[model samples]
Target: MTLASSLLSAISGLRHAFFTREGGVSQGIYESLNAGIGSQDDPVHVAENRRRMAEAMGVAPADFLSLYQIHSPDAVIADRPWDTATRPRADAIVTRTPGLAIGVTAADCGPVLFADPRARVIGAAHAGWKGALTGVLEKTLDAMETLGSKRPDIAVAIGPLIRQRSYEVGAEFVTRFTETNPSYAGFFVPSERDGHAMFDLGGFIRMRLEHAGVETIDDTGIDTYSDERFFSYRRSVHRKEPDFGRHVHALVLEAD
Candidate 1:
């Protein structure tokens, strides 16, 4: 089965797609299409599954660049081959190499893609609440800028992630963030569940991008938890599932 995705023309004129869970060869909780190599799913299956994703993106599977996300503020500058298996412990990756695809695997976390068409620089990052708060998005922008991509000229997209309506968090989640800076209060809404707060992830990301001078932002508002079309770690955990599959969102530059 072929998965569904959303695409946009980024600054670098690269082909960028946000893949969903409509296609592939997995089953049960993994069900039909699980692209997460980090999951318990068969690694061969994951490779073949990624091969399909790369094909859809119009590139070889090896051209797809991604990282084992650690939800940290770190963003790696990937200029060439890096071990995909060891998977650098980073949240974002930036590069100027064409035909190299940048991808992010996310269920509820944000998959962000950036491009500077003039400079031929592109980036992909995984931005969950921790990453966003810790500056992964800004770090990606900075990395791209260092490689000759301008922030103002970059086009960015925030892919399928957990939406505010479907996302609820405990007081500690709120307290720590609030304590870090009450200004982050806008990102969270007061929920009825005790000291819990609902987070507006897309909104928060947009704010960050716009602040960094990226006004052209595409937001895929689909919630992973609320929508069956995508996977959600939080949802899986709530159901007492031992593990959950991850969805991949990729952006790649096609050879001109």
Candidate 2:
């Protein structure tokens, strides 16, 4: 329910939401507001949850769309809604089409929503460590440019994800980032555990967007790992739960 000043100021006409795991019918591990179509939650419950999300965005249920999300750098353009069963395998989606809400699913991973109201273009990306390191955010901006969006005009909001203090990683994970660019090394800090580091996922993402020339970037700064309102895969793993829920971050370009 949080709003980014940049996004709201720049794209006053767009409808967007960074949903938490708090208002759906799924029970137990999937407990409430689990919008992930790929999750093991009941199909009926998932459908109803998605319906609520779409309704909140002021779009029809059929117009709310999300991808299969393989955590790769791949990005696709969505001009129309696709059946859930056949959703494309991609980590990002960009669209200039109105009345269609484009979204990405995430638990601990970064869910970023983008918009350039001047160009009437909007984009959503699922940025896990793999996707972020591999350039999913940059690719999303490039795709928006292709749709006539100026980089400076774009306002991006990085939704809730695991914050640095809660995101511990192995030494190899630190090496993977440093190996790409030594400058990325700064994003990691020493953890309590030996040979481990805590990476600032949100900070790294903000740098990427800034380097790509996006002038307005808003980070929700909510840590999914600690926030009970949001679902987190790492939290679920640590708790030894069977499955975790997923949150949906969506952006819709309303019809004129």
Candidate 3:
């Protein structure tokens, strides 16, 4: 498990974890600790994996919540656990409800956990390039605000994701960002491959948070693409593997 020091020091009375792929029953490509309910991994294996994650967070397995992420900027408020069959199609989730844990899944994509202890509000977002560029982070902060969380008081931790060194983008990708905001050019640097550039996803995500008025932001700085202990969608694709595992980053507001 990886935790952000800033989040730990600033936000009290919350439980969170950026679970690695080292503690579950699944084997082979899914390996162990794969918590993605959407993957083709056997439901039993996924269930057991999620149960382990929930136990680690000190929440009941039934109270651990995740969404059917579609790489959209949509955010939903989770007042209670939803059935797996009805998972909302959202990239972020915010809640003030204690005892319920909200989480987002990511392989190479960014998984961010947010907490405003004073307000007892917490959020989790799945931010890939699309979601981040489309305002998922901002929407997440906005959702948290609706539940009484102050942006300045909210501490966010950027969990494991593909770092810039491992993330390469084509010319069109660069154009998409630059066209959105020419200043975004700073986030890209020329890669060895012609017409391609390396993207600083972690830095971009942090910048978005800062621009959104968040004062305490922590980035784990772990690269999923390079670390075998974590899952990476790109890595799976490069190897032509059938499927990829998903890591769970969750935050819970402890019951008073």
C-alpha lDDT of all candidate models, in order: 0.82, 0.91, 0.91
Query: How many residue pairs collide in each prediction?
Result: 5, 1, 0
What is candidate 3's lDDT per residue for 1-256, written digit by digit as tens?
A: 4454555545668878888999899989998988988788998999999998899889989999999999999999999789888989999999999999999999999999888878888899999999999999999999999999899988889998999999999999999999999999999999999999999999999999999999988888899999888999999999999998998888888888
Model 1: per-residue Cα lDDT at residue 36: 89
Steric clash pairs (candidate 2) = 24-33
Candidate 2 C-alpha lDDT tens digits along 132-217: 99999999999999999999998899999999999999999999999999999999999999999999999999999999999988
Models 1 onward score TM values of 0.93, 0.97, 0.97
| Model 1 spans > 4 angstroms off | 1-7, 10-12
Ranking by lDDT: 3, 2, 1
User: On residues 1-256, what C-alpha lDDT tens digit does candidate 1 reach at each position?
Assistant: 3232333552435777777776788777887568888899888777777888889888777777788888998988876655577668889989887777778889899988887777888888899989998899999999998999988777787888999998998888888777988887888888988778898888888888888789678786778899888889999999999888887887777777
RMSD of candidate 3 to the truth, in angstroms, is 1.2
The residue-level lDDT of candidate 2 at 222 comes to 91
In TM-score terms, candidate 1 sits at 0.93
Once superposed on the true structure, which residue ranges of model 3 sit more than 4 Å away at CA? 1-6
